[model samples]
Target: MWNRPRFDLKVRLTLRVAAISAACFAAISAYFLVTADRAAHARSDSIAAIVAKSLELQQGKVQWVANPRSDFPNLDPVAAYVMTPGLCLAFRGPGGDMLQRFCSGAPAPANPPPQAFAAFYRSLFDPGREAARPVVVRGTKLGETVVSVDPAVQTAEAWHEAGRLMLALAIALPLLCVLVYAALARALRPTRMIRTGLERIAANDLTTRLPPFDLAELSAIRDVFNHLAQSLDTALAERSELTRKLIALQDEERRHLARELHDEFGQSLAAIRALASSARQTAAQECPSLLSECDGISRTATGMMETLRGALFRLRPPDVEELGLVASLEGLVAGWNGRSRGETRFSIRFDGAFETLPAAVSANLYRIVQEALTNAAKHAGATKVSLELTMRPDEIALAIDDDGRSNEPAAKSGMGLLGMRERVAALRGRLSFEAGPNGGSALRVVIPLEASDRQLLDHAA
Candidate 1:
């Protein structure tokens, strides 16, 4: 099933880093932005303060130019007036002509201050600008002079610088993000490798190992995966060994049972048959009632012999180990047909190179077929059965099908089915069961001899 993105550690880390980096970048950039304009304004304020002090020194000494019409931008007199104790007024036109338009109101000026002028006028002189110190004017005192300092140029420069800074940040942030992403991915390379290695391990491929990622932080995780792979390999080896022993034990038990049934039970039934024959022969010389009793005894012994024979056949089957899986399956079909009601039909098919199968594979294929047939007869009200043993170059396939109304419960647990699964697992084979067409069941097993080393080894043995 596909899952949506939820809270994951890696994603959370990435988001946190991005947030912090963006916030920090924004804060620093904003600081520069604000300071850029403020510093410009401060320079303007400093110039204004200087102009105001210069004007205060020129309070009443000069005739104050009374609105000068000449547009000669003169700084010398303006600077000189700043040194005196009187109001001083300075002006410059748009053409950069400085004029001392007014002093502190000796009378109204003949020409008013230029309607459009830009200038810096100061009320006092400071020794730093090398102007005359303010001296006491012997005349009447005048009102304080006002100074104006223009900072249009400085303000524009400040804005331009701030724009450049913002532009640089805009251009660089995405690149920074890209670089950070790459560095983080590189730093986390070992973790990705570990994840991939663990995935392969989960898929039961233990032949591959993760490389040594020497990061001290991740060293423990590396060791854990390596240890896990080693443990899995050991477990798989032990499981294969156990499966081998179990198969061998099962073969031995089958052999023991086959021997016991053939030796003890077959002999006892034979002796009983011989005794019954003798009784029949002896009863002929006796009375008619005795002869009838002998016939009943002989008939009972014959039936007993047949039952014992059938039991032995079930216990041992035919020479499956000697003739291989295909012949054994054919024998099984014949036996089933012989025992089934005359109404039931049976068929068997063999495909591929059946003789090339390994013995263990052959055994598993036969047992699967056996279990399938037994299930069909017991649970499916089958009137016809079909079995197939198909071998390919790479795999061995067995299929048993029946044409009958299924009588097995839909979902109840059954040992017969469980045993089939266990047998397939032990052989490292695969089994599938499906409802057959026309209301019956189909059971199949496909064992890949090349894929299962243990099966191959046992078959070689």
Candidate 2:
């Protein structure tokens, strides 16, 4: 059972409104009930006073008689004249004996109140309370005129009044809740857009921004969100520019280093080899015993020259802009194939024209491929490697797959992969290196071209 409490704003607001309204309704009902109780008591007192005054007048007009029943002055007329519904009247002699009594029978209510309500009403008010006034004439005390209001009648009246209020409350509460819910839903609708904008930001799309909102709070959030996105976009743009400059500077430095090595070291090694050759020739002519030592020196110098050439090739690759990206990559694959010497077969597949590519993109793409191939060859020790480059209208994709040992741990921590990642980030591209399900690993890079570059490629295609 999923018993998590609902966190919906609309629902919670609606419920809170309902609770406060119900409390207000209860307060109103209590006030009405209290007012009704006071009114009921006052009406009973008024009836008693009127009946007592009428009795006094009637007795004063007649002669005094002590007859209990026959000379009771026919009190029925006074009772009848002063009687009202829910009212009761009684007269008792000075001896505490009832002489005459009249009650205006309170009619039964059409719809009685509930027992619970009746009990509550009775507990709050004195239902059996009565108003009494003494009847006296000629300085002689007569029986008391007692008047009381019926409890059942009072309860029925209170119930009717309260029932109407309850009915009104019952009808209005749901409508009020519905209105509140709808208003809250409309006010909070902009939250969905905010969530989507945040998601886009998380996905590295700093250009995503929220539109203006009518509510002040939401509008403030929109302003802050747009400002943050703008700041991030600016920051990322600056960072990428810096990274590109750094990469360009790194390449320039490597080229300088390679040039110096080729100039100074190349001349020295050539001189040494020339010296060894000349010494070997003289030794072969004069003393053939020294020929072996001369040959050894020449061989050693030649091996060192081969090592230096390999280092120079890696340090300063061929110019990608002059030869174009496609030819440069083809040459790269051929060199790798030749170096592997059939131990690992390297292949390249190109889908679209690469001649019109921007120089920066061409350079970064070449470096990323170079780093990936180095990892595959040196780290993974793959036997067969395939490189695929596809150019679409909006983006370029390069995938390298090799049937070799998975070097995922090394790929994650190696400087080569780090350099590749930095180059991809500078190009605002995505890079992924993962082990294949069955065997080796696959490295994929996706770089989206700018509008101008895309247009150039389209025209060239």
Q: Report the lDDT tens digits of candidate 1 across residue range 189-303.
A: 7887888887877655676577777687788887777888998888876776687677668767877887897788778767877887787787777755677777777678789
Off by over 4 Å in 1: 1-17, 60-166, 180-200, 214-220, 262-311, 334-351, 375-414, 417-461
Tell me each candidate's TM-score: 0.60, 0.68
Residues 1-461, candidate 2, lDDT per residue (tens digit)? 89998677778888999999999999999999889888888877887777778878777655554542335435677676767777778777788776777766777788899999999989988675988888888778887777777788878889999999999999998888889889888988999999999999987778898999998999999999999999999998998999999998999999999999999999999999999999999999999999999999999999999989878888888898899999888988998898888999999999988899999999899999999889898888888899999988889999999988886567556999999988998998889888877689888899989999988888887
lDDT of each: 0.61, 0.87
- Among these predictions, the greatest TM-score belongs to 2
Clashing residue pairs for model 2: none
